[model samples]
Target: MANIKSAKKRILVNRTKAERNKAIKSGVKTAVKKVNAAIEANDKAAAASALVAATTTIDKAASKGVYHKNTASRKVSRLAQAVNKMA
Candidate 1:
């Protein structure tokens, strides 16, 4: 409902970006969940592998500006710690 042409374009662009960000965040959440499930199952090997994939997904998300770098780092660190502690 933006009357100005530029404002309408901005609204469209923002909506598209919001959808993309939502998808990226959802993927990150799923990746993290996979890692957590592996850890809870006490499968060391699975957890280790899942952590690597999750870390990669998280890093990509951060690079895409979906997440802040330090926030992503903290997430990876916590997941890695849980996996390592299983040993």
Candidate 2:
């Protein structure tokens, strides 16, 4: 599909980057879900731990450009709020 050599190289590079980004996004989603599940189960300690993990993952994703900085901050803030409310 890519005719030019440069285009072909770009395609390869993009594919690699896409896979990496997908993994990071998946990690972020999983962490967030874990936090939400803990919160729903009324396990404050678990929720707090999950919140820390999720926030760390989200910050990492944002720093790596997998997510927008403001979006990551908002998510972390909301998650923290939810966890805090569990007490």
Candidate 3:
């Protein structure tokens, strides 16, 4: 649909970025789910480990612009609090 060369290039680039963002978001969701599942199981040790992995994944996603820094921080904080409360 893009007739201009530059526009065509931009379309391709945008498509690639969209795919990358989608993958990152999916990974973040999976990480968060793992933490939640561990918490629900009442396994403090598992929850703690999951939290660490989730935190790292979230921070990386934020750094890569997949998520806002404050949003990522808030998620990490909530997950940490849940894990702490389980102890």
Top TM-score: which candidate number?
1
Runs in model 2 with CA error above 4 Å? none
TM-scores for every predicted model = 0.98, 0.96, 0.96
The reply for model 3, stretches above 4 Å from the true place, is none
Model 2 lDDT tens row, 38-81: 99999998998889899999999999999999999999999999
lDDT of each: 0.96, 0.95, 0.95
What is candidate 3's lDDT per residue for 1-87, written digit by digit as tens? 989999999999999999999999999999999999999999899998999999999999999999999999999999998899995
Best by lDDT: 1
Worst 10 residues of 3 by lDDT: 78-87
The predictions' CA RMSDs to the true structure, in order, are 0.6, 0.7, 0.8
On a 0 to 100 scale, what is the lDDT of residue 42 in model 2? 98
Candidates by lDDT, descending order: 1, 2, 3
- Worst lDDT window (10 residues) for model 2? 78-87
Better of 1 and 3 by lDDT: 1
Tens digits of per-residue lDDT for model 1, 37-83: 99999999999999999999999999999999999999999999999
